[model samples]
Target: MEQQATAPRPRSIAPVDVEQAEAALIEHYPRLVRLGYLVLPPALGRNRRVLTAHALVQRALPRNRVGGAELTVPAPRGTDGVPSEPGYTYVRQRVLRAALDAGRPRGRWQPPRPGQLPPLLPRVWGLRLFPRSGGADELALDQALSSLSGPGRAAYVLRGLELSDDRDVRRVLSAAGVEDPGAALAEADGVRTPAGSRDTPLLESVEFDPCSLQARPTDLMRRRQHTRAALTAAAAAVVCATLLGLPGDGWGRDGAAAPPYAQNAAAEAALDPAKLTQATSSAWKSADRPGFATWPARGDRTGDRELLRRALAAWARPGRAVRVTATPGTPVGPASGPPQLLFAGEVDAAAVVLLHDGVRVVRYAEAKSGEAGAAALDFARTDAADADTSTAIVVGRTDGNVRYLTAPWVTGTAVRDLLAPAAAGQPLHRDAEGVTDATPSPAPSGGCRAWPALRLGSRLVTDLGELVPARLTVGAPGSPRDVAGAQALAGWAHSACHLQSVRSQGVRSVNAWQFATQPLPGGAGSAAWLCTRAETWRGAGSRVQAQFQVPGSRPGAPGAVVARAEDSAACGARDPHVLAGVLWKSKAGAWYALAAGSDDVASITATGGVRGSARGALLAVPARAGAHAELSALTTAGKKLTTLR
Candidate 1:
């Protein structure tokens, strides 16, 4: 959250042209951060106020950065006191809701013991924007804002500043996790106009620009820029130091439309039913990437395995979604297959229990990895799920892959097409369809079976995007619209806080998944070990440095730690991102990494040791941490061009 322009925010909730939406977001950038500054104080902490606000803004940046679709959000009120702006109210309400939700106290709420809790509205440290220049006035406002309950505070902000209709404010409040909307409304009404303060003191003031509160830190920003440039130059100069680039943003194909794959879908390699049960199995295995392990392996092969497969199929019904996963280190109990009670990877070693309900809401309880996962919950009971809720729920992986359920019945074709190519040459089951049915598939006269038939004509769809008159595809489940009829339901409400709370969780979760797969960075080495804590202060995201011991680099020489990939899942044998580096040490025992590259055969053979090959050259010099030396460039083929020492 540096005092700099950040990734763009969304401009509208309603589907609009992508470029127009981006411009709208950029136009409101400053105001958006200010709103975030106030709302996110609780979650991000007031201490690093600037950074936290920046983080929230950055978090709102869509997944596909350059050109992508927009997410669903409550449409703005046309000049309802507040001037009209596309996505203004939409982004604002979402930012506020995100802050409130993030700042919400976890677990059953209890008043903190007198001395147990830190003071409410502790003084803001990093960056402050307000009426008091960090004086009593600012503190008073902070006290007032913090004093209000999460929903109460949100409701107050909406009505007071947004001038949102009262009903609309309350509706948004309910969407922000208020169990009782009426209670939240009552609380906001009582404090709509506090005794002596205006709702938005900082915002309503003439001196509202945040820069007025503090001078720019040009030196720090400049230092960051220079450091990256220097480091990149040194990295690019080495033989094996490969290039890294951000992911492309195109969501769908342009130019020419290929023939619909459904016609030729038969050519796809057959899927292996047994493969689905393995922790490391996928229907879409390819030479460059591993098959996804989210989907269950073959069903109908065994009693419990068949049940699990039937459960997965039922969950994938049109309205249901579910994906089963096997966390690493979990015991592969006998060849019997993973049961409902399997180890879940978590800090407290929680186990993820599989639910029979057709929707997915992977639940974790307070327990150890191998100790839990036994108890399952009704899909409705998990995170506001209701009777129409899915028996199983599906979630997408960091890569655009999903293993889960849906509602209604479409023949097994959808599941088959969605599955990784079945094991290349396996005999096909003309009726694999029944096993993959969203509706419960009957067990072949046998061992185990799924109980209770699915409720018909009771499809669950809590999202408004899909229900909207003309739904947009850019952002969904994460779109801001929490309810379809909020605006009209709230008689006096001008703006609806179209919310997609799932997006909030999705943004953080993707990084969590990305960061979790560290042991697999495709570096060629004897073995790599974790050497440092994950440092997330890299401005963009967290990263950790690790080293693998390359035997012949030098006697007693340990491998040098280098930048690890943030999204290692996308990297593979042909990874363009460099992976491992050689150790350059001085007699004084200080060491530095001269260069790093993929540890694949050619790269490892070329860059590992001082003893060089005709096709490879080792650029060696006495280097220490933060120590820079002139570097020479080499072609990918290892041909040397003398540029500098």
Candidate 2:
């Protein structure tokens, strides 16, 4: 885990300063632009959109009356820095509201007002000496968003771009005159461009100040030529057929070697079976080094790998029509039956098949006729030799990501113990991506999410079975996070990660507990975070009986611990489990703590000390701290689970 630098937290609202206000606005200016772009639904042109977005941010900041007449506005601030009420968050909500006002037909204000600067005829940024690359993705998204109704667009942007929770999302929808937040959420989920695809990331700025941008007339003309040429090339790339055209001799409008306008040999071969066979067996004019499969299979191997490879190779060829041998053998693998061709007969015309023998998996199209083919053949042979007929293959679009093969949850003591609550109707939980593995890959180096860990029920189950919880950290922040909650438990699970705007639902028939984050005192990019832990139990079936208790943790004033040792009357939860630990400052002005879970809730007689039914055990290093740092987690049962440093 990376250490978080402790910065002083504002205990209460302070008078605003001009420098601080400008700095905050400048720092967050890009984010405001992104939010504005999404909120308005981008119907206006780029420059207009940028100008309008800035105007919205101006309206959203904090304002006060000067001399009981003129209004003086300042940067916003709020109490305790809750995601719902933080200063930046407050301004963001107002911007969203302003966007709704500008975008809707019946909105309070009509945007594209005459006061904004007119669109400049040219983009100087596009006039670079080198050809500027473009993604058709942004254009696609703009079109998609424009088609949505104003409210739906607002909901999508808030949930998709702003990363608001269902609660915040619901509020936005309400502001837009929509009553069903859940349905709106589901609809947004359906229409939104997927997260990891070509969708324009909301964090990046694509618009520039057109008024200040400059370019020479010749360069501008050249840029226009390049733009048309690039579009032409891109259009050509998407087409499957190769028509007659002058070969690579001509310079494209952009002054680069035009892609050779030659026919696809694969397409030519597919029109004739004999041609297909000849093409598959022919040696490549320029072959790369040997890899996974470049050779043939042995005598006893039931499957004709050579034939399979050739068939798939032929299948992958453009404009080429191909088919498997009339009948495939009962090759066993994926299931207890014959060899399985996943998505068999349905491979996209542009795609090929992949074969795996439970050990080494290879993309058949990538196989060569020598060492690579031999390696692939050997892989199948070895699996067959062991009588493991679990050979199966997956077919899909050709992006190089390799999805790991997984098996059904095994019936074992470990699986049983962790899911013990399921017998009481407590649904088992996994991440939305399905049962990927026991743990996920790693935290994306760049993104909103941060690292988190937890222990549940008195015993924490592992691959080896339920035992004391492991010392958790960022080591495994990827898939297959331990299943922690169902809908009932999930209600309170919100505290685990208040910072996360997007969320994952149930998988493996269970729900994995996820976390939310808050910005570090410095700014965006996750650094410091505030989260909590709790113990759960089932009374009747899988319902996380109202008895489940959540411990409270308040990280305030930089690295200082402002533990909610005592519950306030406003604490609305049914079971307000209180955890306690010392707040110690370190010599270097950093704050940290080493603590264990003790069920010792302090009693009325004890003088500000540890107390509670801290039956659970814990050990964590909560970031860095100045002076002597202390830590603890307490239970609502009046027991204190504390560790002092």
Candidate 3:
């Protein structure tokens, strides 16, 4: 009797019909699209990922209807608030399968399936569409996801988006053609969710949502050039066909080419090397403006017509093999007319050319060995660049060293380690072209050991991993002066490491202002609060940080960044005021709410759990550990100011 006993037969999952699948997909369109986006590879870029996500979800409807045969899948368990529905499960599986397929690397012999290729039905032109940027946590999560494999990403998305358990996730991945579902799940475990984010999952952030998107225009001028080129090719083909039909060998003995059609005179002049503008050696002395426009062209190969031609042609239409890059907000369009030639000469193994077109600085470089198709072109926005900001331009960079071309006004060039204030500036020699000797650049990979800054006469400029170095200044926002004095240098030495946050941000200048100093409770010593603001060439995306430097800290130790914000008007020339507060633990092991404000603040106050008001801009109030508080201040001008976020 015991041997005859057996387990009951398992129940079969109901098939999802096309009508039901369509209803479920339309109802949960955004959620499905987001799932697809998270599962897809980040290398496809945001624009393609957005369109592809929508395409995958739209095509998830069942195509087979014979005998009502379609997707047969178990309904969701509804364990994590997701509704349990057979239709939703069917369509979700379809979207997930396509997304995983899209992320796979294409093989040489294997032909791409419909889902593997870029979606053709939802094509976008002239505009790059992507999801809005999220906070630091979301950005970190996205970067972590990018390092995972296709199946691993799928597993993570399934767990986050569907809230499915391991058993359910394995079943789903196996059905989606994943060979090793367990391995994929194990790989996904490597990504650690951000702390204190259980209430708001990073997976649901706007950074991963394709339904809500931001649109930016692509390279409009380049698109127009491509259109013109296509039309020109078509016209040339017609002319050749007509000539071929002509009698008498279809050509004359002169062997002359056909005349050009629909050519732009200004464009032609822009591409002509001879038309490049060259400033006089003494132009800066008498010029109305002291910027790139007044910089003299100084280089040995300035007159090299062949080199100049190659640079100009590459600027106009760079080949596919050429590496072209541009800073944020920098335009890479062809020069409108002869651009100002800043420099053209051999720097190391490559011949380099620098050109300025009023709003942008274009750098073109090519191999000195006359390599036919190898070249590089770079663009950087230099709008509103004045004498202070245009003190130097990076002439050459190789390995970890960088060479700068100083302005004629710069009487002397010196190299100084920004992290070492007491260290004297080392003299940097310049050649006849005003190019300084190669010095160690601030390597991000090297950590905060040392930061090399270029001291051009009385001004200080540091490379922010851009074509143009960002000038360093110190003082009040309304009237900032170049960093020069020992006190200013000492102040900068403590804040130099913070500049890494603003690297490659198209920053024109960074100003550090010592806002307020407060004595710690129980005589733990005084703490200085400084605010550093990075102003960009685009006049947007500016970064502001409020730093707290403890008294008697190590000489080379950087200040602790207490608060930071992006694209904020506070602590800028327009505002010239900032207020921030942080919880501090003194040496006595007592907690205090410390608040500081700029000089303009008439009074400082802390509310909420910790309450205090001080006549001056600095306030310290004893409070329990982990207590929260709100900070506000009244300016001398009778205006209320909140803490800069």
Candidate 4:
């Protein structure tokens, strides 16, 4: 993992100084412009809002406040040092908001009108100086710009000419033109010349077009002529197509359809099956390669010589076999039986199938995971010749991401263990497009679920299994402490017990011997129980369980060593079976839960139990050691329900 760098300290500089602000801005202006341009379209280009935003922010400098002492806004910082627009993010956000607001419809605000600007016309160029030059088009553009209204011209210059946003364009128009140009200009980026001026055509600011004359001018005069012709042709074509109803360029002169353009012949062939098969086969057999054929079964060595010759010619090169064998799986398409294929070694998850035709083929198998490994991808097993006919191939998910494994044939084990989980109750089918392994909409019957129980001690236990006295109780009768209440035995069969989550009937707390069947080791059987000093407590309250003894010595009782169960109490409630560890919540809203394993649970057990139990009885304390217990107190108001000790 990459380590994060420590943040730098704020630069000590006077924020109010406009000079410093400008200098800072100048340093970061390129980046700001690039970011702003990236966010907003260039067709709307640079205008007064951006310029004003730049200036206002620049003047405010160091600190983004009107007066430095009044509101000392901290300067924004970059990697190396302080930024010119210290709070550039804030300023940029504001500018972006304003720019967006300008685009929306409101009572007062309106889109600006579009107009052209004079094209660049150098004095050096004449009409005949360069015969094909676009001088006339340049002149026309200049004339168009000259004729546009002042507001229209300003809008075009700021937005279209400079390639800035509409907000900035509006600002420029306001600054350069009338106080409020208002509706004089609408949608002001490109020049929209009025229709039907037979004698004079306006040019200069043209609409965005990749094939526009501006980009294609070879000579000045030619460019001018071409642009004029294009416009005239477009206008005439529109009228002709709409009113005259002309037949467009429906077909080529020869009336023969031309082949569509393709990037490469091989790619084009791949798109067409007929061409692809022919090309592949011809290319494969034409090379100066040994000949090979499918091995035919020999009876009494009749075709044995022929088969050997075929195999040698097709596979053997110099001395070694070129192709290994035919593919082992059933042929996907129409075939006599399973397709025979020459096997190459496994590459990652894909099984390489080399054929005598020297064609490269790939077959994938869904890989089984969790057998053993550090990384998830390492759980794949590669087999050279998996020719089992009973096992079907288990393909990976779409995009072939998951590891795949293939059984030689269709078998129950292959389907149950490998395919079933990976299939995730998905539909399976083999078609020309390979395999369709889609997740079943409604999951298939017999979906996978958590196993019955985990092996704690020796017995097989279920969630509903009874909790007996042996599982909870510690020592024999009349021992020094008697190991009563709730407590875990240090060493015994009781230590190997675990209780899967079970639904309780009602509020119950007892310190008596109860045989409880629990999860077994290796997650196999359902047999587990504990002796005395072990208690199962539950409730979202403090005062977990009270002790008839003292304040800290062995409180109410010990609890079950839960593995992955969630329980909490505001009082001193600890898990009975602290094997998997215990979790407790304090009245102060502090949480304490042990980490996984025996060591952590041992730590929690050392702390002992609480002196009392909470009101909300979400727990059922089932302890070993014959001792009668009863709920002492119960809360009456709100959702708080605690059991009195």
Candidate 5:
């Protein structure tokens, strides 16, 4: 009787509502594009790769007849009853299958006939490292994909591009209809598919080889994660290692004290009390520059001596067995005056070189980056500034393999209160003995007032310098012993390569070895050092400290600066040995920079050139209500002085 009213209840619906499905797919397009970018290499131009992948995704998904802006049909769901993470499994599976199909050996696995398959297989492109932008070769990627069965190509793409984690990657392979998806995925990880091989002769004119990326996908994954950490740690280690050695030859194995020389004492005295003088002022001042009272003497080799004692007390923890040794064969000449300092660090290999005369100290990486060579695996730089009282230059290195160098163009106290101890004593060979007998002391007797310059080394400095033993004010993480000895060896091995370079004079026999000594009782870690005889030339004429650096790193980043001093006396009132400086990234990200006295800012490009700018005039005295004489004098004299401020 109610047939009219009950008429709607009798109809059974089809499994998938096509009209609603089409609507859902329209909504899914945006997700498809994002997923494609994530799955593909960044080097692939954004437009082409993503658009193609989107089109492919649209065709693959179940669609509805309603095709305008709105999706008319409901999207499909897995048996698990959830919409998957847009690209998580399905797309990953497809990409892998696609890559495999393109690269699989023709005879190893049979392929389905073209008539029975998806229309776009021939249009699919296997991903390539360097894809051709526009030309006949442009279709090469698609051609490669067509050679594989769908499932094989998907496996190759996902694994090679670093798209997903292991378990998920497996699941994706299975869903793509791959035979023994597990085996194929694993094989995809290991063997080079023909289409993917970079060097393999091409099936067509296209040069891309999908197999070139073949590797245990997990192996590639592990490498990617470890690189960042490894590079940072190695760089820091090198800086610590090299700077530690700059002070002196470390203590000898048995432990004996060395003697301090007049040159060492003079270097120490020069830094004690510098006055902030004008750039045109004479090198020396009437004030007796008070040397750091706690600074170690040249002969304090055993690390347990009085020099280290004072140094540790004043500067914080001092490493044991610190020593300074002049390169035995270096041609010793009359003192040019004060020695100019230089610091260098490399990223390809974890190594830092501190040069005063010869390579006063050197440290190397045992592993990581690439392979240790002159190539810019890491970036470096150097800088300098006037600290009101004195002038100093600092060189810094970073992970990207870049270096920066900065210094004062004119002689003023450019650097002062260098934390580096005087070159003294024989090197200590073990970590257990890196401390001095000196009693604990206070903060720097006086603030270090000087002009500062810095050098940027190639690559990031990775050593957690915070972990080394240093003055608490210096921010070392732990006592030096916490990371010294063989444990430090691990640091060396974790980098891309060790730093090696021919000295400017080109002494073929130069060999510098750097390692950490035993931790001292006071919790200082010392760096051991050794150098052979060689010839060195300091600057005399225009004072060009030619520093070679690998840029490629953000500016103001840390690096190592190597300085040569033709006349040590020229560096009077400044620390002539070694020092470290902070590197900040520049706005454009190319050059490293530093500012001196508010108005002057100096910038050093990655390629190594110096340029400076000044903001305002200070020479003219401001007129005051009561000070007529000084104002009148400045007004008259200031008019005569004309130069860009």
Candidate 6:
């Protein structure tokens, strides 16, 4: 009996068959792919990594009914509610093993595995696919992961994605062929998760999910050029052979044209400068439509055919040295036909040409000295241009100064500091060509010190570092009026600095509405709640910001941004109603939850961490510092609303 007690029989682990493994892989495809994505090296780039992660997971199924080899499957702990089946465990290990192998460097003599190379099964052409970009925390986490070793990344992914304990991670890593699981675990300990993400691991964020992706075209212009070149080369050979057989001295007349054998009349017509459309001086007043089409060419060089040809050629086929940029949603394609000439002249040291293609305003600039390879082309979408919005266009920008080409209807132009409402507007002189003298532009990176805007006669416009300056208006959403009166200007001064958030967003107009004026709890003077909504030219991606400004703050000081939202109808023409709350500290050092809504709100309520209710649109409740609360409101129309974020 003593001899029989020498050793207890080791538990026999069941094998995972092909059918079982395939079923598990199919059921948990997204989870497995995410795990593989996190473990794969970031140097492969987002697009390739997404493809490779999927490839690894798809190849994880067992080869035959009888399992090829035993896998270390930990007992179910109910951490993620996924059953700890042998099949799932086997496929998970295979995916982990492949991901780690993909990160390893290829040896000169060793044959490369399928996982080590770019995946061929799922391939995309003429497009780049990647996960949507995350915030700074996600970027930091991705960089930290990139610095870890293959095994270390595996350890971290197991702990984060698989919700595994230290023992399970070590076992999984060892099973995945990690030479030193303990060292890998120790290495992973050095990489901490992003701050404020303890409850939700960064591994589960959309940035790391390969299944959900954002797609962008890859070098479309270059692809088109390549295709055109290939077709031209084939056509040129045929033309050359035919000319050599039939004609005498075929290259004599068509010397330069011999190489460019593909001659399309429409393409040539688009590049011709003489074909440019020009409107009459007073066409806008009598025309059926009021837009760029009725805008007469005004610059001094409008009749210069050579300069116009250069601009058209550059727009059609921008060289490698040309710097091209387009606003968010603007098209940068070659001209479809002759575009309307808005302006053409030398402003500063560059020859500038502005063209309108019905939908976008295109600006092309070249060095006046005819510098061989230096040029710039910019495009801004302007689908519908009216008298107010078409008041000004940015003609030139150099150093930290910008010049504007005022509309013919603009009787006078003056520069006003948006942050200084009390200061009188300074007169800005314009030349005979309607180009205004250069003014100090807003320092985009220099913080919110000052915002210089153009006060054109009675209308106000501000440059957002875009081709067209955004029109500034006051009053309610649907029927906004021109920024006028001392009260409107002062209100704008408090919230002008917040405009930086909407820069380069193709904003057509920015309306400031003082939705509510709430008195302080401890008589700390009245505070104003403003809703600034920026409407873009593309009719989408509108930005709304709710700001709270306490009375007697520093002059030109930006208000505290309580809440912000993008592409939301709230605080806009359609909805025109918004609710937001903030934890404010009174002058007496007492903390209180202050909330305000539009006039249309019937009642407002605060819940969680802090609780209060008010029948009107404003609420003030005593609360501790840093209290968290959820805000909901009922409008007069009985519509329920949550606080904007």
Q: Which stretches of candidate 6 lie over 4 Å from their true place?
A: 1-262
3 or 4, greater by TM-score? 3
Clashes of each: 56, 76, 0, 121, 214, 0
What RMSD value applies to candidate 2?
Answer: 23.1
Q: Name the lDDT value of residue 539 in candidate 4.
A: 25
lDDT of 2 by residue, 495-611 (tens): 323212111110001122222222222222322222232211111111111111122322111122334322121111333233233333334555433232222333211122322
> What TM value does model 3 have?
0.60
**Tens digits of lDDT, candidate 3, 3-70:** 64222222336876778888889898999999998988765666777898999999888777621254
lDDT of 1 at 535: 14
Poorest stretch of ten by lDDT in candidate 3: 251-260
Error of 1 at 175 (Å): 4.6
TM-score of each: 0.27, 0.25, 0.60, 0.16, 0.23, 0.60
Q: Model 5 over residues 1-645: C-alpha lDDT tens digits?
A: 654211111111233344444454455544443334333322122333344444445554433442222221112223232244332333333433343343333553566421212235324233222222221122223323323334444555545443344444455545443456555455455433333336532322221322121111122423444465466657655654674577665422111112233345544432221210122122233224411111111211222223222222111111222221122233322222232222233322133222231212211111222222221111111111112111111122221111222122212111111111111111111111111111111111122211011111111111111111111011011212212233222232221111122212212111111211212122223212111111122222211111112233222222232223222221111211111111223334433332111112121111123233323311111122222121000111222111111
lDDT of 1: 0.32
Global lDDT of model 4 = 0.26
Q: What TM-score would candidate 2 get against the native?
A: 0.25
Worst lDDT run of 10 residues, candidate 5, spans 466-475
Summing lDDT over every window of 10 consecutive residues in candidate 2, give the lowest-scoring window: 501-510
Residue 398 of candidate 5: its Cα lDDT? 23
Better of 4 and 6 by TM-score: 6
List the candidate 1 regions with Cα displacement exceeding 4 Å.
1-13, 41-45, 64-74, 80-83, 105-138, 174-179, 192-203, 206-212, 215-645
lDDT of 2 at 543: 13
Q: Which pairs of residues collide in model 6?
A: none
On the 0 to 100 scale, the lDDT of residue 54 in model 2 is: 64
